[model samples]
Every structure is written in structure tokens, then in C-alpha cells.
Target: MTWTSYGATCSAPSAGYSASTFASAVQLLAAAQCFSEESLPDSSDQNFAAYDFIIVGAGASGCVLANRLSEIEHWNVLLIEAGGDPPVESSIPGYHFSLHNSDFNWRYKTVNDGRTNQGNQDGCIYWPRGKMVGGSTNINAMMYVQGNSEDYQRWFDAGNTEWTVEDVRRCFRKSENYQDQLLDQDPDIRNHYGHDGPLVINTFNSTERVRGNKLISAYDEIGIKKVKDINVANAFGAAIMTVTASNGERNSMSKAYLVPIKDRKNFSIMKNALVTKVLINDLNQAYGVLVEQNGVTVTIHANIEVILSAGALNTPQILMLSGIGPKEHLESKGIQTIVDLPMVGQNLIDHLLFPITVFSDELTENSEADDEFDNLKYFHNRSGPLAQNVVLDTFAFYATNEDAKYPEFEAYVLRKRKNSSGLKKEFVTLFRFTDHVADSIVELNQNHTLHLFLLSLLHPLSSGTITLSSNNPKDPPLINANYFADDNDLELMVSGIQKLLELLDTEYFKSIGGFLGRTRTPNCDELELGSREYWKCQCLDIVSTVFHPVKTCKMGQLESDSVVSSRLKVHGVENLRVVDGSVMPNHISGNTMAPCVMVAERAAELIKEDYNLY
Candidate 1:
């Protein structure tokens, strides 16, 4: 019986549950096969009772690290993820949008600062982190971007020898697979990229090429020539984007690394086993993690070490809970302070993106997926528009701010709205005036609106911090994303919108005849271009985050000011290492996924090299 029937069976007559509910009574049975958690090694599997190394939070870092460290075939490695398992649909590329706002996402919201001059009074924005086994890697927009050279070199300049630009390039090379579409355009790009790597990075294959051309033209107008590949080093203008997909499907770390080595006798996974705290003994070294499963608290000791890959949000929380944060803060919360590291939860950074929406009366997303004939094709051939991501398309990189010489904002053009393809026939005829379909305007075609993602990169300048709300490990870490605290972040986004407006005035855009000014939107009318304050307010109202949170637990020699050291060991603490985004000393100017994977690789090497595990 299933959980539905079990729930019904447990209800009393007064509660309205009847005898008819007996059909699906699995919940009443209390069987171990309940689908709450992903399948892992059975508790009764005494053969896998303990491991030499146990990593927590099977995200981008944990999954990659687990697969790599467990490859030794002799040493046992157990990876634990608390988000449980994903529904079957989540594993498929077609159901990507459906997974959002559902169980698969972390669904974290912002702290809601009242400083915003406009918009909702709640002052919070919905921030979703991947809660499933693969973490955010499973749920991100799939943009594959390596950080800028200056970003990495800044780390070395700040005393992180392990994070020199060359070292980072080597790490990216180990896990990167350059796209054919990008390299094919320019053969000189062949040696520029590293193809034979673990991570599958390829360009999104689509039915139409309008978005790509638009991005290319936008960059040309801005005087930034498109580069062969951003990951190849120099990144300046909008070019075709490469995604982390394998054959038009998402290549999550679980699939790329973990599952392939699942059957390795020494490797084990404990899904739904929430590790509450890191157990440190008198030596102040991490001995093991304390986990709670099925109302039972079980302590699993790792003789060698414990790596915390819980990500930026939870990693710092875990450290503080394990008595490894600032002394005063921990003591006030009634938890014994193991190490006084003030910066454990400070210096949190994220990319805030403002959606610049414009109406297109000529073209809309080609959603042939809605047709009955297309349904047959998808069910049988697995081809056509359904196989492609509607949100995937061309991207533009350029400077939107006066002070910024490099690209400060990015635009991702889409022919189809995310998950909105099959719902309406409006997308196709929406842009009726554009070049591609203008000749067929008598057919009542509508153009598509541009979803301009004004991403904050290059120099965010402003930073935030993460702190523990309580000593309880169960409470979520308090996240205060001080977004838009920097003046440049606001100025740059306004410049980006103005740039888009400039694109509108071009003959090409004028020919289409659908201008953002005629839309009669409230905010657009209120926006005054001459004043910085007005533009800044507009930026705050329109801008949102790109879900790239990093540097919560920075690494540095200053133990009091840093969360972890260059070795990723928690400053002032022994045998405890942070192998996730938390170890970054500062924010990178790109998506954190690829960088996190690189960090995991470097972390594994650091652990192995330091411990001499090999």
C-alpha cells in the first residue's frame, strides 16, 4: 500500500477517513521502502557499517569528491545528503522547469530588507537552492562559465597559493568538455579549450537561431567582439553559451561521477541521513559526524577525516554548530566555542540579476511540443522542440556601468519562455514584425519579449554575511544577502537597461516596431534616466539574484578574520576541512558551479596530499 492509503487508514471515523481508504495503506505499514529518501546502503548492510572517509552534503562538491576519493577501490567513502531523493521526472531534461517550486528545490527566501524603495513590502525574494542529491548542479540554468583570470589571481595575491590562475585553469581542464558549436566556429579555439575531461560542456542545440544572432549583434553594437569561448581565458562579449548538459540532457554530478562508482564495494551513500553535528574530541580534531535517521541518533566515526561539502549556506552553519565559529557568538548561543573564527559566516556574496522584459510582436518561442503530432515524436523519437530547453539560447556580455571597463551585465535570449512553451500558442505569433516571420505577418504572428538577465559580475564590491539563528543544527542558517549595498551594482544595471534601450533605437529593432516604451508599464514610466537615484531604485526594483552564493567561509592566514585556511582546514581547528564554495576568499565573476567543481577537485588533492591517503 502507498502513503496515501496509509494516511487514510490512520484517520478515525470522526476525522472522515473511511474503510474505503484501505486500498493504499503503505503509510500504516511503516516499511523501510517508503520513498522519502533516495535508495542507499541498507542500515543492515553490516559490510558497509563504517568508512575511512565520510563526506556530508552530496552537492556539486560532495558528489565529485565522493566519486574521486572512492575510486581507490580499497578505502571506504560514505557520502550523506539530507535533501532525500528526487522524483523520477527531475532526472529528465524535459521536466526541468516543473521541478522548480516543488519538493526538489530548497525554496529559500531572502531576509527582506526594508531598504528597497519599491516593490513588495515583505522585502524578501524567493531564492531556490537544489535540495536533491545533486544539489544546485541539478537545478541551475546550466550556464558553464569559468571565472576571470583576475578573480583567481586575486586569491593568490590574498595568499592562496593553491588558487593561482594557472592552478585554477588546470583544475577546470580536468573536468571540462568544450562545445563543438563554439570551437567549430573558430578552429583556433581547439587548443584553447580542454575537451577530454569529466564534465560534459556543450552548446545547446535549438530549432531557431534568432536569439544567438541577436546576442552577437548586441555585442557588436557595444564594440565587444565575441570570443571563441569564455572558458578559454578572455571573456568580453556575448557569444553562444555552453551548458553543462550531456546530449541535450543535464549532466548532474550524481550522474557524471557518483552513480558510476556506486557499486564500488568501498563506496556507500546514506540519503536522508541528516548529519546534525561534527563530533570533535579532546584533540580538537574532527572524529566523525553525528547523524539522525528514523528517530535514532547514530554516530559514525571516520578514523581519517571528515570533509564538509555542505555548500556556502550550510557549511558555515555546520561549522558553527560543531563549535568552530566566532567564540563570542557561539558562547552567547549556549554552544561551546571550539574555535574563534569570526569570518566563518561573513563575506557572503551572490550575483543579483534584474529581469529586463520587453515585448516582441514578431516572434515567439517555437513550441511545437504542444501539438499532438509533436507529442508522438517526443514519446517515440525523443527529438524536436521538446528535447531542447526553451530558455537556452544566445547570451550577451558587456559593460553597463561607467566605471566598469569590462562586461558588468549579461543577457540570455530565449525564443521560448521557461516551461511556458506547451501552455499557450501566444509565443509563436507574438513577434509578428521580426525579420524571420515578417513576410508571414498576415497569419497573426506575435513577437517574443526579451528576458534580459542583468547579472552583477566583474565588480559586485558589496558583500553580505551568513549567521546561525540558533545553536540548533536543525534550524536553517540565517542568510542576510546585502544585495545592492554597493553603488556600482546599481549603476551598472541601469546602464545595462539603457544599453538595451539603445538596442531598441537601432534600425533593426525599429523595423520590428515593438518598443518597450509603448508598453505603459508603471515602473518604466516612473523611471527617470537623468538621475542616478532613479536608476538605482529601478535597479533595485527590477534586479534579482543569479543563485551564485559564495565566500561565506573565506580562507586566509588571519584566523580571526577567516573561516578556513588555504588548505581548506577550518582556521584554528584541526582535521576539519571545508571543501565547498565556502572556502573561496572572495566572489568570482561567473557561475559558481564550475568553480565549485574545481574547488572540490583541488580539495580532494589537498586532503589526499596532506594525509598521504594514496
Candidate 2:
């Protein structure tokens, strides 16, 4: 059928029905049927059965552990998740933002410190974590960035001997199955990645290539040279990112690792299961978990170990609820302390993002018709704007000092079309910007297209903490982001903003008539708009997270400072381990998804060796 005829058919009324309508309607019906048939098995019937290994939180790490540990045919493994299956929108890359504030998201909000983030809604920042099987991978902008080698070097130097740069790289390679077309053209990139793994990694099929390339050129002119592959170059430049997707669909850890072995006799997956506490014995050994599922609470035992892959935030909460946290803090909440590990949730670190937006009159906005056609195009062959991440597939990483081994700043570019429909929703609902700030952005978009440069302080000296709001597991953990707690962090962010402002002077930007757009904030009205002081003011008022929280349950050589050891074993507690981003000693220089996978791969090997499974 012709494309024009299909479009006409989609708009036809009931009385004007034609053969084209039947054809188009049947395609959608068939697609829905296929989606319904693809479902994960709910093994809740076997909830009472004991397991050799019980992994809490079916996130990036937990899913990997479930797949790897269950490989041994004799061992029984249980994977429990707090949320149900991912929705159809999760599979579409461009719909990544649509998952926010939905059932799939944990929808966490940082406690309003009444100091920073004052320009956000309710004077608090929104932190969205994925509650489903793949965890944040289901909601994240699927960037596959294995942080700089020096990041792991610091881990090794800080008494985490098992995490040497070489070992870290090897684990990343083990979990990656790089499928980008560049592999056939570049030997260095080809040799740098694993080719036989289950997780597919490829560049997004971006439809905004012309504008994206122009932005890359602008970045190069500003000293962030365009590299063919940022991964091979150690994240020293700007480039199109590789993503965890295959054939226009998100390849979450659940899709890559769990779906293939859903029917394994030894593997059991329990969905909508909330693990309230780790069941520790009188001797401080975690034997199993107390799970609240289907409105019923049950104790599921584990013969070997109970691993906490419940992410940086939830893992520590679970530990504290089970009486394995700070002695005095547990007592304050009327829980007997089993282990006096004070660092259970002390060292929280996250990458804070500030917007440095620029407006251009030369760019054109996408129309409603264009969006509808793009949706139809995706249903046809999965090839359209809907098949890729929304203008988020490119990135620029740079260091303040030219000789620095790791990047101090990371920039993400997002384009907002002029007079576009979702601008208010994006600024208010997704970003939680205050009414004035959101209105300013929406108003500016009516006249000029916006190029928002979201600059993030990659490694902040300032760290926050996750503490118990109450003794109840159902209560959300109290998150004190404590951003800009260190003066040096704000200084670094201002420096990064100053450097990014140079992009307006680039040839591509100049040709497009680009000019710096100021968001109206009452706190910064007295200062000069483009001055360093004004940028610093904006940093304090407009800051939000990139949702990369780590190091809450830090790993180190001493129990005096850390909650877990080099082998991932919880200090002062036997048969309990933390395998998620919480074990990170420090924040990585880039995104956390890829590094989380690598951490899990290494942990899986460590578990196998300790148990003699191999």
C-alpha cells in the first residue's frame, strides 16, 4: 500500500471505512497480540521453597547474578523484584522520559534542605529510580559508558585490590557484546570490546544527525575534540554514544540475561516482591530474607548466601532494617543492632546537573504531523525518531585541567523544538523545576529553539547520606543529597559552566545565531547575567541529579570507614554481600549503568570462586 493511502486510512471515519483501514487496523492488532505473548514467568508459587542463593533487587546487578549463579544446574536461585514487568513504552528509546513518575519508577524525592535546589518544585529535587526488573536500565537514557580507567585505579589504590584497572576492563569486556558497525572499520574499537556476550551495544539510529554533527563540531571547537569512539579514547572527547539497545528496542539486563533462562528448572523469579529485611541469625549471619508479596509476608531461606543488589539507596535501607547498621541510630529507631557498621549509608555520592541553555533562531521545530508520521514509521520497521533516544545520544566529556587523567565535567545536549508540546511537562513534571523557572524555559521556546547543555560535576568532593526515616521498611529512606556541601564542588561547576559558554562563539553556533538564554531566578537577579557569580548562583538554585547515586555502602579495607570489603562481603556480617553501585568507593567519571554491570560480572566470578561452583 502507498504511504499516502495508509495515512488517509488512519484518519477515515467509521462510515467511510475502506480496505486500507482494515489493513492498518490488523497490523496494530497483530502487534498487540505479539506483545501480550511475550511475558516473563511468575514463579510466585514456589515462594516458600528454599534456595542456594537469594538475590534481592532484580536490578542491573541482581539480574546478572541471577543468570550467572543459576548456570550451575544443581543450584537453586531466587530473584525477587519489587515491581512488575516493564511497559511497552520502556522498549522504545525515545519514550525513556515517559517512564518517569509512573508505576515503574520509585519516584523518590530528596529531602528539601531549604538551602540548595531552592528553584525546584517544593524546594526538593526528584530522583527517579526504576522499580521494575531491569531497575534504572528500564528508565535511563541507555548510554553505555565504561568510565575512565583511572576511576578503577583509584578503587585499587584505596585498598580495593580486586578492582585494578585491568581487572575492571576485563569485566566490562565480559559483559559487553559490541555490535556497532564501527567494529568492522576500526581495529582498536573492535579489540576493546567483547563480541560474544549477551548484552548488545550499538550506536542509536538517531534521526537528528545533521544537527547532532553540528553540535559535535561546536564541542570540538571548544576543545572537546570529536572522537570516533569515546570508549576506546577513555572518554577524553565528544562522540556519538553507544547504547544498550538492539534493533530499536532497549536491551535491559532483564532482556539480555533473564528472559533467556526464564524456564530453567533451578531458577525462580518472584515479581512484586518487597524484601523488607535480611533474616540474620543471633550470630549476625544473613540466612534468607523476609519478603512481603501479594499482601502476604513469608520467610524464604537461603542455604548459601543472601546478596543485596537492591541498589545504592535501597540496599543500605534493607541492611539498617535488619539491624546491621549504626548502633546508636538503630537503637534510636528501636531496633537492636546486630552489627555496628556505622558506614552502612554514610558515603552517598551523585552527579549533580545544571542547565546552561542557548537559543538559536536558525533551527526548525518538529511539527505534530511529523511526530505522528514518525510514530507510524516506527510501527512499520522500527526506523524513526521514536527508535532512538531523544537528542541524548551524543555527549562531551572534558577535564578542567588539561593534564588531569580523568574528566571533571560531563555535558549532555538536549534540543527542545520551538513551540513544542511537552516543554512544560518536561520542565515541571520530569525535572521538577519551579513554576517560574519552567515558565521561563517554555516561554523562550516559543520564539527560539533551545540547545540545553546539561553540565554535570562528575566527581564531587561533597558526599551525602541515606538514613532511615523510620523503622518501617515501607517508609521511603530519608535522602539528604547535601549538594554543594563542599565549596570546591560549586567552584568546579562554575568553571565547567564558563567553559561550556564558549560554545556560543563556535562557527556552527554563530552561523545559527546562537545566544545564551538566561532562566529567570529571583536569587540571581542582582548579579550580572553572564558573569561567574551569576553562574554560581544558578548552580546552587537550579541543580538536579543525573540519578547516578553510588558509594552509600562503600567498600574499603577497614570496617571503621566502609560497609563492605574488597570481596563485596559486608563487614561484621557473614553470608551477606552488596553487589550494586553502593559498593563503589567513589563515583565513576561517567554514567553508572555500564560500570554497574561490570561490577556484577566481577562479583559473580568472586561468588563462584568462594563457593567452588566452577
Candidate 3:
């Protein structure tokens, strides 16, 4: 497989091609330049470095904080990232599949306990975290969702009074730079989005493909209303999915927030640098961080604070490693406990998505010649299927059991996880599920498939934990996602699958030749297809993560139930705070990226307010 300036000549992706697939190699090198880290300003010093602020993990939140805090001119900020800059492949919206499990991905796996991942041979699950400048945004689906308003209301209800719906919506608007030029054509939709932030949010024109409109029509036929924008309140219906991209390229955090300010002397980025631990004084004030780079260890001091933004999985790991976690767990690992915050790694919650494959009689232009044309189209004008994401245009958020306060499930019409094919095959080999499920997915990859209905549980009752496997900072954390620990999660998931089947059977879907494909598992052979019992077994068998993990470093008023304060400061430690997805007090209604960015925006304000920067 050779990569060209326009695109690459490679074999079919594991998840197959969708309208969002890359077409050609044109401008590939130029696009790659957009995310390159070589041009970032360097501020490394030969001596021990001290700065106004030291932000750990140059992820979604970290990048935003760095950009915002550094704007004060005199305020020196240092951002450290475990991974390097994203590669050129990271620029293409459709190439996200190839980015996973690669050098750019942390590739963290969970330790299963027989309750979940029962379909896999080893009873384990694969969790991929971004290890690059933009962090997970470098490899995510790039969906731009702000989550339901009530989701934030729950945060306020949990003693977090500052993060009300109005406050969060303000932060959301403040953090976004909506580039949907079409919005100006509609006054109602125009009022729903922000226009002056750095990040660009837009959707592929609905007329660009027939599949997305067909899905929307099917949803409408099923009695679901059509929403003008899913990024605002009342996202309880089908709407065109917006993405975090400008033109056809991925608008990662590093690109959106960091690139414009790369030359600022007050701002410095340390890539490929792993922070070992936060340096705390006898008074429990964070002074700096111990970072390892190129076999050399150095202590970088932060005069103001040490902000932890290493994401949901790694933030708690870093805290625990610094002796700021549970007392008993730290003592057992032979690490001296500095601040015994039991809530540090607890309250782990994530959304689980079950991919329901359907067959369509229509053939998509995914052939070799068409791939070249698509690449050429993207290379020439940044348009066509190559310009979009894997998911189609329509997204539906609905409740299965609860009142319409918040969605119990979110359904998206998209292509398969071509990258997950190999992973699914491994699950089959591990006896995670019988051949009919994983193997069938692998076989269907060779077909001319169109769309997939990925029904994800919006609010799960189950929660898990992230613990230390070893004291070594180089070693990955032991993640116990503990999926489906509560039976209600499975029940809601089964109901969601039934709703998807109903959509497939709609006249609108039938007019487009959409047919439900049977997902058989040996464990459910006795139960009939489409039966609740069969789906329950299937949900337990193949249920996987949607990658929106949060609340591990929970925020609350009490120290016993939370890690960070309502202001985002660590409960007991002074001059230390966690400002990432982990600080979310509850599960969000949609993707976690927008919420994470919103957290960074709020964190910046809180930090500025504390220092009287205004």
C-alpha cells in the first residue's frame, strides 16, 4: 500500500467505505502539514524549568486551556503531552479507522470479570485512547454534539451549582467557532450555533448523499420529529449530524486551538513527554511535575498550579501515582499516601454502542476507480463522501424507559467500524461470541453495505473504576470498565435494538431496500431472532464501548464522593486540579468531546478569575 500526495492505494478498510471515505491522495502532504508539530514554539531550558502553569496531557481540555491562559501575555504556560503530533493520516476525516491501535493510540485494554464482554473469548474489551497532540480528538469520529441541557442540570443537581444549563451553553458558544455557512440561510438554525470560536462545526450538505436523507425519512416515518440542530436543547429527534471539521479535514484540538498560537513565546508544548508525578509540598500544594523525556528526568515547577488533563483513564492514574487516591489501594502498592481521595478512580461511567448491521440492495460507489475519483474530488475541492465522517448525516436521541428529560439512547446511521473487524475476529477466536456474530461482521465487509444503526445507551446505571496495575508510570492502568454491571442498562439496550428493528421495517426503509440482518450467537440459539431474550444475550455478548468515559475524577461538594471541587480544584490538594473528561459529575447525553472542551473553557475562566486576570 503506497500513500500518494492525494491519498493512498490500499486494501479495503476493515469497516468498509462510506460516503466519508477518502477519495484521493491530492493535497495529502499539505493536509498533513496542518497537524504537524514541528512548527510549534520550543521553550525548553537547560536548567530546571518553572512556569506560571504546567498543564498535563495536551488533550482536548489541555490544548484549550493552554491557548486561553497563554493569551494573557505575561502568564507563561507549559503543556506536556505523552504523545507526539498527529500524522498526516490524522487529517483525513475517513482515515480515523487507520489511526486507532497505531502509534498514535494508547491502545488501553480493560480487565473483564466475566460479567461483561462475555461474547469475547477472553472476556476483555479494547479501549483506544488518543496519544497525540490533539489527544482523542485526533482519532475520534469528529461528531460535534453539545449534549442535552438536562445533562448539565444533573451536574448542578449533584451539588455543582456553577455548571447550570445556561452557564454550560454559554461556555459551549464561547468555545465553538461554528463554520456552517448554510446556517445563515436559516434564522432558526442560525440562532442554535455559535459563530466566533476557534473550533469549526459544520455538516456535509444533506444533498451530498441519498443514504442520509433516507435514514431521516425512515426516522420520520417511525414518528420521530426532525430537529434543526442536535447541538442545542430538544435534541430528542432525528437531525443531520454536525462534525468538528473545516472543509474536508479533521479539526483536532491541536489544530483548532494550538496551531494559531504556536509561535507565542509565552506558550510552550512539550511533546513525547511523560509526566511521572506531580510534585507536592509538605503543605499539599502542587509545585511542579516530574517529566521523563529521552531517558532524562527533570522537574518542571509550576508557580501557580499543576493542571491534570490526561483524560478519564490516565488522570486518575496520575493522581493515584502521586499518592492522591484511596488510602488502602496506595498502601497496598507500597506508595505513600499523600491525599487519600477514595473517589479519585471510582464512578467510572461510559456509553455502550451496539452496532446493528442492515443490508441494502443499492450499491455504493466504493469501487477502486470510484475511490480514486473520490480522492480526486477531495483533493481538488475538499468535497464529496471523502469530506464527511463515517456516520451518515442523521442522528436520533430518544428515551426508551425514561420521560423525555434526557435520552435513554442515541441512534446514529453510519458505516461499520472497519478497523474493528480484526478486533472482532480476535473476540471470536477468544470465544467471546460464536462465529455468527463476529465472523458474520467480518464476512459482510466484502459486501456493498450502505449504513449501520449504532444504538448507544445514553445514560447507564452501571459504573466502573480505573486502578493501578503497577506503580510504574510507564505501565498502562488497569481499567475495569465493568460494563453492564446493572441489568437495567441491558434492558434499555434491548429496547433500543427493538426500536432499531422497527425503523428498519418502516416503509421508508423498505423503499430503500433496507433489511435487518440477523445477529446470531450460540448463547442465544434457543431464542428466536428479534426476541427480547435473544437481544439480551446478544447485548451481553457483543456490547462494546462508545469511548465516552467520564466521572472517574468526579466533581462534588463533599470530599468523600468527589475528587475535584465545584471549582475544579482537587479536594484536598492545593494548587492542583483535574480539568478533563474525568471531572464530569455525570454521563453526558452525546459525545464527550464537546463537553470536555466546554470544561476547558470553564476551567480557563476559573483560573483567570482566581488570578484576577481580567
Candidate 4:
């Protein structure tokens, strides 16, 4: 089938595509059944007996653990997930945003804090988590960014000695299987990236090349040199982003690690099974788990350990429900506390994004490149705009000021905001914004303006908590991110906005007719557009989450300040561990998925060593 936009239809394929190539693509598509609904293996094929390891969530970390642990023929691993297999839409890169609030998402929202979430309605921000087998990675914008080296160094300095930069890089390399196409361009076959592993990492198709070049040229003109490999230590600059996609399809954890081994005799996966609590005994030893599936309560014993991979939010909740949290709060909720771990749900850190948008007279939504034609092209050849994430093409890391020890700002280029009304919004009565400015933003957004820099604070001093709203496992927990509680975080964000303005003034940006000062930020029209004071006010008003929440069940040396130990074992408990984003001691300088995978990679080795599995 062919598609037309602007009254022009062409059967001619893209530059790299040809009629013979299309024939091969068609064969591959049919062979792989790429668009078919997911068919998860039936757990009944294997007996539901006691297991060597019972992983609580079939997410990024859990899937990795399942694959690695089950490699030993003697060990039996049971992976339980609260959601079913991923849908066809999950494989499409551009449908990342549309997956939110669907049945695939948990759709949890944080409690209203008068301090930050000022722009959100009722002070609450929509926090969407993937409810499917792969967890958040299934719904996330498939960006594959290994965090900066310094971020891992801080973990070592914080008493996590084994998590040094060199050590973690080994773990990253172990999990990565860099695509041959990507390495073909480099020619050196560098040791910096893993050449053989389960996960496939590569760059996007040629459709994004032009937009990436434009963004790189604009940044290069402003003295930010084009960095070919940002994966190296201390490296910075713009380049075509690396992603967790093999070819055009998203290579989620399920696709990369789990599905290939689903039929293994020693491994089993349970879907739509909600684990209520980790069953602990009199000695505070976790021996099993109590789960609710199909409205029936079932208990499964674990012969070895119960690893909680329920993510940053749900992991702590599961622990607290099992009576392993702060003593005072547990008693208040009428639950007896087994351990007085006050730090069970503290130290929550997230990356906050502040958008600076501008109008582009050169571009419009109805331009020759439209969504329908792109979709048609993707269906036919799997090489088009739909194959890449539309949110942004390029990313740059920068230090907010001279005092900073690490880069604090990560500015992303988001060019499309049409159909962006689905984003969170606040009632004007609650947030105090003028109607004219809000209307202006709405009007410009409809006219196909460019969403310039979404300035994200890589490190924020503010922290929040996750508490049980009620003693019910089915009810959502109360979450307060407490964004901008620290003055330094706000200052850093304001600095990032100023840096973006500096980029807009560059010759390359001006040549593209980019002018940011023309449109004033919503509710801040009383002040000058380019002044520092006005930007600071706008920063406060527009601050929102980048959806990178972590550090709630942080890893540390002391029991007083942390829930899990450096080895990922929960303090004061036996055979219980948190193996997901919740165990991060601090927020990493990049996306959390890669780090989550690394944690499981290391955790598996530790478990193997402790049990002498080898």
C-alpha cells in the first residue's frame, strides 16, 4: 500500500530502500509476526512447586535475573508480574506517549504538594508506570543512555566499593550486544561497548539523520563540539542518540532477554499475579510470598530468596506491607513492625524538566511530512519517522555552574507539541496563571512551533517519601516527590534556561528563524522575556517530572539511612532484596533502565557466588 501527503503519492522507497529490499522486509515481517498480539507461554506446562528464587516483578531487573539464574539447570526461578504480555503498540517507537493511561500503564499519581507541582491540577502529577511484563521499559521512550562515569564513582565513595566506574562498565558491557550496523560505522570495534550480549543497542534509521544533523550543527555552532561517542567517561556533546531498538522495533527487556527462554524447563513466568506481601517468619527471614491472582489468595514458597523488582515505588510498598518499614509508621497503620527500618521509603529523587519553547516560521504541522504517510511507510518497510521517538532527537549534558562537580543540566530538543494537550495541567484557580499567556501558549502550540530545550535537572537536592495511604495492598500508596524543596535545584534549573537562551542566539539557530524571546512564558508576561528574574519565575511555574524517580529504597552502608545493603540485601532481613531502581543510592545522570539492568547483572553474580552456583 502507498500513502500520499500534499497530494503527492510515490511508490518509490526511501534512499536506502529498494524494491528487492522491500520484498525481504515483507518476508521478515511475516516470519517474525512483528505486528501480532503477544503470546505469553502458559505456566501450567510446569508444576507450581517451591522455587529456588521467586522474583516478585517481571520487569527489567526481574527478567534479567530470571534469565541468568535459570541458566543453572538445578535452580528453578518463578517470575510473577502484575500485568500481562506487551501489546503490538509497545514495539512501535513513536507510540511511547500513547501507551500512558492505557491498560498497559499503572496510572498512579503523586499526592499534591503545595511546594512543587504548581502547574498540575490539584498539585498532583500523573505518574505512569508500565503494568506489562517489561515494566516501565516497555512504555518508556526507548532511549539507551549509559549514565556518566562520575555518577557511578559517587556510589563507590558512598561505601558501595564494588560499584566503581570500571566495575559498572563491565556490567554494562556484559548486558549489551551492540548492533553490527552501529559498529560498522566506527570501524575500530571499540571495547567501550559490548560486542556480545543479550540486549541490542543501535542508532535510528536514516529518516532521522537530517533532523539530527540540523540539531548537531546548531549545537556545534555554539562551541559544543560533535561528540561521536558520549558513552565514554567524561565525554560530552551532541550526537545521534543511541537507543534500545534493534532495527526499527523496540528491544524491550521481554524481547531481548525473556521471550527467548520462556519455554525453558527450569524457568516459569506468572502473569496478572499481584504479590501482596513478602512472607517473613519469626526470625525475619523471607521464606515465600502471598499473592492475589484472579481474586484468589495463593502462597508460594521460595527455597532461596525473594527478590523484589517492583520498581522504585512498588518495591518499598511491598516491603512495608510485609512489616519491614519504619516502626512508628507501621504501628500507626495498625501493622506490627518486624524491623525498624525508618529509611524504607525515604530519599526519593527525580529529574525535573523545564521546557523553553519557540516558534519556527520555516515549519508547520501540515508540511509534506505528515503522520499518516509516515505510518504507512513504517508498516511497509519499518523505516520512517514512526520508527524513531518523536519527543526529541538530540541531548546535551552541561554543568550548571563552576561549583558543580558533575554535569547538572540535560537539555533535550523536542520539536513536536501538536497533540500535546494530553499532558498534565493545573486549574488556573490553583496555580495562579494569567489566561492570556496560557491561551498564547495553546495557540502557538497548535500552529506547529518548536519545543526547544526541555531543561532537566540531572541532580536535585530535594527529597520526598512514599507512605501507605491505607493498609490495603490494592490501594495506591501516597507519594510526595517534594520537588524544588531545595533552593539549589531551582537555581540550577534557572541556569539551564539561560543556557538554552544562549543556544537560541547562535548563528545556526538564527539562520533557521529561531527566536525564543518573541513568545513569553505563560503567566510571566509582567516581566521581561529574556531577563533572569522572569526565567526564574517561569521555571517555578513550569517544573515537571522527567519520570526518572528513584532512591526510595536506597543502597547504603548504614541501616539507619538505607533500606538495602551494598550487596542489594535488605537490611535486618534474611533472603530478601530489592533489585530494581529503588536500590539506586542516588539518581544517575541519565535514564534509569540501563542502571536497573546493571543492578540485576551484579546481583545475579553476588547470588551465584554466595550459593556457589558455578
lDDT of 3 at 528: 83
Per-residue alpha-carbon lDDT of candidate 4 for residues 158-195, written as tens digits (9 for 90 to 100): 99976878878888999998884754466443667887
Q: How much does candidate 1 score in TM-score?
A: 0.83
Clashing pairs in 4: none
Identify the superior model by lDDT, candidate 1 or candidate 3. Answer: 3
Give TM per candidate. 0.83, 0.94, 0.91, 0.89
Number of colliding residue pairs in model 4: 0
Worst lDDT 10-window in candidate 3: 10-19
Tens-place lDDT per residue, model 3, 279-397, is 99999999999999888889999998899999999999999999999999988888899998999899999998786777666554465455456655665577765567656767888
Find the number of clashing residue pairs for candidate 2.
Answer: 0
Residue 443, candidate 1: C-alpha displacement in angstroms: 22
**Candidate lDDT values, in order:** 0.65, 0.85, 0.78, 0.75
lDDT of 2 by residue, 1-614 (tens): 11223223221111111124433453443234233113478899864668999999999999899999999888899999999877656676767776777778888999998888888888888899999888899889998999998899999999898888998999898888899885536999999999888788998777777777778888999899999888998988998888998667788899888988888999988999999999989887889999998789999999999999999999999999999889999999998898999999998999999988788887565685576566666666766776788765789999879999999988988887788776887788877888888888788889988888888899999999899999999999999999999999998888888888899899998898899887977598678888989988888898999999999999998999999999999998899999999999999989999999999999998989897864
Candidate 4: residue 234 Cα off by (Å): 4.1
Residue pairs with backbone atoms closer than 3 Å in model 2 (clashes)? none
**Where is model 1 more than 4 Å wrong at Cα?**
1-49, 179-187, 365-382, 390-392, 400-406, 414-454, 517-532
Model 1 lDDT, full chain set:
0.65
Residues 421-458 of candidate 1: C-alpha lDDT, one tens digit per residue:
22222222221112222222212223444443344554
> Candidate 1 vs candidate 4: which has greater lDDT?
4
